[model samples]
Target: MKIVPSSVQLLLERLRATYTAEEARLRLSRQAERAPERTLRSAREASSANISSLWRQLGAAGVEIAGVEQELADQRTLEQAERYSGNIEAMVGTVKLPVGVVGPLLVNGLNAKGLYYAPMATTEAALVASYARGAMVATRSGGVTTALLNEGVLRTPGFKFSGLIDAGLFVEWVARNADELKAAAEATTRHGKLIALEPIIDNDIVFLLCRYTTGDASGQNMVTIATDALCAKIEQDCPVKPLHWFIEANFSGDKKASYIGLITGRGRKVSASTVIPEALVEKHLHVSIDRMLAYGEMANLGALLSGQMGAQGHYANGLAAFYIATGQDAACVSESAVGFTRMERREDGLFVSVTLPNILVGSVGGGTGMPSQSAALSLLGLKGAGHGAALAEVTAALCLCGEISIMAAIAAGHFSSAHEKLARKR
Candidate 1:
């Protein structure tokens, strides 16, 4: 479609004074017409002929707009590509847990006293056994608790910025100096939400990650612009220099992190009498359980895992389509797909868990307001109050479960026949 005509532009300029970016895009397009220029020319003519014809039309209309319409078409083409890139994640299979592991699960399921959801139910199985065992080893010495901290969502105005800033102060300033932040936000034609997190862990560097919830369509552009602005501000205000900054992590561009999402918790305690026999470890788990135990290795030592290795689950492709059809900030999925699994040996048994910090899931706002996403959320029974943190926890659990299942099968030498067998006609 052609850009709005000058007369239409005058009308829209007045209306746009109050329009949001999304609204403006729609209004402008609605008022525009596809002036698909055609010219009588020999087949040998160059492609530039289309541009020349479009320029002639605008020139006759007394509009002084720059560039031929083809250029505008090219610009939009690039933008469209950028918008989907973040949502289009790579596909790696799901990883499974080791074989024959068993244990108790102690999730530090506490909260700010009055919050509604905190239940630590135990799911007994080979997988749960391994997780509980690992937890015991990690906490054998004592004080091995898992805490759930949530850095919730923040809304962004329809504006764009280009700079760095301390996210803590930036958000605080947004709160204390609402007038100024609002003014800045109102100045741009773009805006989105930003989510920041600071790990409660100590000794190690603080983890500052952010997720920008771009409303409707892909939010890649909006997030990039907003973060650039925020980062610029932080660089100017904060005293401590940031070691690194990224727009996307884990895979979904929507999920970014200051550092890698890691597993950090005390190893559980395991009693010698309760420990899985060393022979069983090598035979079933395929790992040297005896050596790990003797190395004075905290039986509950933490494990660093890789991406999905066995199961075929959600990939970047499905997520992108899901985001598009649902109206989510598709790019956030980049950071959301960094799936991982962790294992630690516990006195009672080995602990196995999965962690995916890049899970950019939501049930309200934008796409959640759409019919399809709402239906999907309802199907999962997550419609009412679950937010970002709950999704992250669940995704992490899924990864860990996969790990436990995979490892168990591998140790038992059953993974191939159980999950990976491809049947053929006899």
Candidate 2:
């Protein structure tokens, strides 16, 4: 006897068919063309004298420049400062941050393995030391296990139509011509690949959620340029013209925290877990396994009551410091900090794990080329290509260390005292 498929099963089959069809078309039309060259006018050398010249130019333009020149330009240095042209505009002196090391953190991950000394650049006192203590405990307990679950960067572009019929027709056309759009997007960058194009329709509006896998780089600007090219192609070819459209509809959750980022993820989705022996927890954290677990439950409740996106403690402390030290987009911490922390009881010990859905980090590109940031990445042995996943894994593990330490401190009733001793003066 033959059995009929259920509604859910049929829906799954249809979705699989749609994906396979798009993949087949992409494979067939994989030839990518080079993007058009765009250049900006070169700024003068990034030297103090050149800065003074610019200040003179600004002064001539009747802009008040004496204070800025005295404070920022006077403090500027010439050590490879010329390279700052691409990274900054209207050059001012760099603000120096004290960099601290938290490791020999042992990470057993798919990409990241062995011991690493993670560099954290921040002004916050006791942050690095707390992470260091947690790292020590984790290493003694056989290290943290990390996994890079998924990776995708999204860029959503919206379109306006006269009515629902036009919007539906546009969505159908986009779905049918996904391959061409993918090709156009891929043409803009050698490293970025257009992995998926999802159409979300609302009445007379259609939003195309363009997702890409950016190789080795965070791919923010990469996706934007590629999507621009794809939009241009759509405008030229699609028979149904949009009444209005935009390159980015602000639906991607770029630097802001949102429910969509928590659900679907924006960058690298990574998780780290470890089991700290009960004895180790008692010795190092001065807290019993049961106490830690109980505190975690209370913390989870407080997070929910406060409307937190994901229940966790101080994921931002490690993420922000790591991002700044390793040359990632620091603002991304707003979204990257959204994650879940789980603490459960095991026969052998207390099991602690952290799952971060949005970890926008890269081993190369952007600020990674800067002198201090590059050095920090080198310190962790995570510099250059083929290390983005490893870097992300390390980041997740680092966050786990922070979570463990904070939970232990709060549970043991030492959180305030430790901070007072480390951060305040008598």
Candidate 3:
């Protein structure tokens, strides 16, 4: 007789009771009250035990398992990809994302400069095509010039004092002892370096925005650990101890679409720009330069009226795709895509630029090491430490190209038609 090598959980559960010599009745203590112990025992004794009683119990309760049959088909191979430990509550197999490619885009940046392909994982049908069209235009018009605009990661540690006077005194003390505070913070991590400790006073609270230069990782956890270390040191040595203190006061603007993160820049920020001649715009984008410029103004006005944070055309589309393909923390897209896009006609042609103020990324951390995600990064040749900035510049250049194609597609009355053909074909 042969037993099926089944789901590890199902195997463990069945054998635990059988080998322990515990009767099925005693084992069903946490089980449903409806199924009598005798029936459970009979079900367990059945030769085809794995799919018998428990599944029947769940099925009787109006639950379905057919859809998971295919998902669990290759349980063994899927189990090997399980990279999580200690924090493991349960392991459900991976869901697949459809990854596509757009670009042979040209980017001129301080760290990365070349023609590159962008891998985009998205469900939207016309998304990759829109970006490809944008990249095509940029490539024809030379390339987009990119710059590393700013670099910093912040963790806001908040403190509460009895009165405003105490808060003011605390702020002064922090300012005076910045060197010592930095030393304490630096003790926690090898890669994170303490750069700035900015204090903000609100009533009786002191919000110290602890900023750091994180080398290769996204640095959220790095900065948080270091700041906690600094906060502990402050609690021990400061003359006026805070009435209450918390690790995060929400000022770091981790995921929020705040103006502070937009201006001060929470993570890697890069700007990509290009000047496309009027004739090239017409040939590739199928729109006149003057009309495109007019449309830019109109779009800007609409964004202002709608209270939108980012005025660019479809910044999220490219950023979200790139993030998914590169295995970034997807939630960062909320703040990462928030920026200003400006377009002005120059004597040469058109001046188009996009400033992505925050692109929280890492080459050595998070999900970047996962099998498929690692392949994606390696495909782009982005590897090792200090490559995070290079990724940001590439992403910004992709965004610039995407913006150009989309704005032009809309201006040339191709938006609906393009989507109708690519997005919803019968």
Candidate 4:
């Protein structure tokens, strides 16, 4: 299916003239300035003095030293420091962020079917307030409906061959010996099961896209380990030995946005939708349905023009905050943020929906074991096993709330003013 509908494409083409040349000029003019050349001193020696010296160097470089060392040290106990062994390299200290709660956000989904107070960790002001407003509107309008559509984690390992014929034979061998490969992959992990192995040939390279269902975990590392074992077995048994092979072929769209991920999905595929009454829209957002829909159309046009993989307003904002708060892999947000947002006019009100194909989140692994993150997950009652689906659903709903709120703000011409009033600290 085409990501952007034909009707919307035609509409954008027709309205292309409305986009002023000055606006294009301003956008083209905006560029990043070059940074000053300076190297911060660091030592391999782990000592208080070395750390202090680094901080002093930063201070000398005109950086604000906001007692970050003291605050991080205050939170870090010896036990907590021990816990950071595998999670960090050359452990310095932990930075604390202000976590805000937005809730009583009612969600009606297959897994998430209750009122959840989602904790968002961020420094951006008014973010929590904006989501809270949308949540309130959704709750008042009969709650957001969500669904866990599909779930799988992928890791593609590539094998290099001398020519197309060798690669073709290898692909045939992989297709015929699926059972053996599955057994090899499954042997590495108890919870993760090898669901499918698709072989794609590119001239002399053959990429085996291995998909897995990781129980209650995001499964980046899990899939890598499993795929590694599978590759080892392939190397040992396959008659047509490859010239070389690598664990990751960069075809799985790990930690990066890709059209394949948008289509096939890399992680938990989820969708959330809610209807806001026209009266509620005006009451809360101070915008009419007509204006909101118009703005949404313009936003969609902008997304298409910018070559965005999926059309949506700020999925990263909610995903990033939620991931950090709930101990998810924050880097996964790159792919996780790819989604489609639809806002259509309804008889009673406006129907807003968000479909996120890549929501890489888990309630059991990674940072979920951390004390602060665990507490945050517990706050939403989404800690430990059997709650991964619910966590994904809640994440989709949270993103839906953000989409509604931001679209309304932009339509009502309150986007900049709200940021100025709330974000700027005089």
Candidate 5:
């Protein structure tokens, strides 16, 4: 479907025009003339009347923000945000993303089993509805099965040597002292466990990607700190150190797309699958299961031809909403959404699955503790260390639901119509 690009200029102009009422401008001018020496900040500090007068001055100054003013009309206070975030400035109210619940999406996972009302935060009009539709069909078909297949957070520390022999010798030394390196890494964190050290050997350079299993947390920060300690230990202990050594040669796949993440997986490696009964497919999705399979074939061909990272439909649509609602590091969406999804004709119905190798999500750290984010997680029955594994599985399940919905839309040729009806404001 074609997406209409938003114009920041146009939005700003509307805000300006909407709030710049002639009466408001005139009232502000009279007030300003009455007390030309009055300052807005002092007025705002004085009383409610002065605050109203201050807003008038801004409006009279040609700033149109009546809508924004109305939106922040009852802003409680900004002081509390400092607990969850750093570098606090004045509280800038809120950007109220409409949150919608999809499901009773039944999920069977190692940690999470049962029905959930998945909270999705998004601006797209039909996104929540689409996911909810997929969830309904999946629920009727007996739910998605999710597995936490693997877990790791990586930090690749690089070493430079004079020659191949020197680099090879360093690699040998590191391997010989693997236990000590592991100890050094583990010493830094109570929850992080040093699981493996994977090496990439160039002629005269070596990159040791340290992998860790961080319990119940995404553990990017935990893994990075542990890797730093390990590197320091190597510098101090390895007598035949490289001519130079540095932490993070960029092979760890932090906050960016890389083959390393796609292959090795930097966070939770999760896979979710489901079988939709034939009757349910046509009844709920309004398309034949075989036609969905054909669309999948076309999409896979296109992904292969275009060298796309993920061979799936609309993984980002669900993942972005999920992450934003849950207060996950939304940037992780870049890596998390690169999913491998498949659909095939089955004897009874259609078999579908989504494999998300690097689903970097957490229920404890980062934005999960913030009020809105916490509420979203709580809505899903996920909000702490114990729920991390379940969160990963749920993420995979949600991705599968989205893949089914989007592919069905494309296959049925209703993608554009759906968007035209739902995306545009009436």
Candidate 6:
């Protein structure tokens, strides 16, 4: 979506509280006069000496410097337009499964740059309204748009390296006895491929990690089956003695118990810790940094990691809705949800930002090609691979906006004003 020019004007209104037409026009003129290129230069030039000055400019102009960085990154994403042609994209794949509770419907503005959400599925219907109110709250607090902003993606490859086998013997076996091995593996109705990977040890077993793009599905199971078939072939072929016969899959390392030896147990509760800047608390722009730090100390940031809350919260309600509307493995949200939200004093106000590293989101292939998902993709004006990352960047921005809005309300003691009319009547 196009960035609105009125966004800056709205922020000025919040800061000035009230403004004449002339004042509004002047603010707009100042922002307009600052070229996008200059904004980039200022961000790049942010130094200890002039950092305060640069921050004041951003605060007064209602420009988020970090958001600009995300935008620049998005504009440079690898797409067909970038002319990166490789079979790797075609080789990697994904799979989806059903698991866990589907909690809460969230909402955010269409033009929003980040994520916003409410807890409890019962509260889902009100999510959109809450964010809209939140948007207004932010606008009044020198904020401009109510939308979330995200602009990038992260992809985790589906394969890992394994130990080596006797390359000379393995090659000889493949060449001399290909027909026999193929016939035996076919007995079990297994489809497989033979590829010689780089060696590991001094020849214990021919270790091959099967890697392939499973074509619009989570390929974990398919890879496992194929690997098992190849293992059986190795056992039969040119074997001096197959010692150290072990299988590792699911991309987890040898540290985890083997699937055969694994004993399932009840899941454990999660706990985590994080640091928050103290200056934001002093500005009444946030809860006591101590409180957030305490929460982290007590529990892992799982709930906060999802939906629109906490630092690094992005993925506008639209993105989640889009994920659901499409056939994506929404539970993948678990890994994709990990990120950081940071607040620091900049000039007289606060500068807020978020960073998400393991946002294992995908765009093309898999459910993205489904009919419903295709329609949702159309709605966001997205096509091909990098849309998921773009959605994520927008989601993170919205999440930061929500936290900032709530923090401002609590600090100003106006957090409960939304229900004031009913409270007064009672």
Query: What are the lDDT figures for the candidates, one per model?
Result: 0.37, 0.90, 0.82, 0.90, 0.83, 0.38
lDDT of 2: 0.90
Off by over 4 Å in 3: 1-63, 72-79, 84-89
Better of 2 and 5 by TM-score: 2
Q: Show the lowest summed lDDT stretch of 10 residues, model 2.
A: 34-43
The runs of at least 3 residues in candidate 4 whose Cα sits more than 4 Å from the true structure, single-residue gaps closed, are: 1-68
lDDT for position 326 in model 5:
93
Taking all chains together, each candidate's TM-score versus the true structure is 0.37, 0.86, 0.83, 0.85, 0.82, 0.36
Residue range 1-426, candidate 6, lDDT tens digits? 647678897886786787787887886675654566444223332133233444456656677666553332232231221122221122111222221122121223343333222211112343334444434433334442222222111111121223344444554554576556445433443332322222223343344333323322333344445445655666666454444455542332221212211111001101111122345344434455444444433333554455432233333342243345444545554443444555454444444444433332344554556444555555544446534434443344334444444444444456577345324443
Tens-digit lDDT track for model 4 on 18-118?
A: 66768767766846564557777666543455456766787788887778757655544333655544455444557789999999999999999999999
State which candidate has the highest TM-score: 2
Which pairs clash in the backbone of model 4?
none
What value does the lDDT take at residue 101 in candidate 4?
99
- The digit string of per-residue lDDT tens for model 2 on 1-426 reads 536658877987887877787786776784646442432332555655565566776776667876766665544354466766657765656778899999899999999999999999999999998999989999999999999999999999999999999999999999999999999999889999998899999999999999889988988889999999999999999999999899999899999998878999999999999999889999999999989989999999999999999999999999999999999999999999999999999988999999998999999898898888999999999999999999999999999999999999999999999999999952
Better of 4 and 6 by lDDT: 4
Instruction: Go through the candidates in order and give the clash count of each.
Output: 73, 0, 0, 0, 1, 34
lDDT string, candidate 3, 312-389, tens digits: 888888888898898788888888889888999999898899998888888877778766677888877785676888
Q: lDDT for model 4, on a 0 to 1 scale?
A: 0.90
Q: Give, for candidate 4, the lowest lDDT window spanning 10 residues.
A: 72-81
Please write out the lDDT profile of model 1 over residues 1-426, one tens digit for every residue: 768898998987888688888987876685435564643332222233433444555666666756534444353333333232222322111111222222222223222111111112122233333333333333232212222333223222221122233434334444554344333333342434443433211222222343444332233354446545555554565444545544333222224431333221101101111234344455545656434333323222322233232122233433343344334556665544443334457764554443443345544554555433455444434453434333333323333333433455444555455432322221
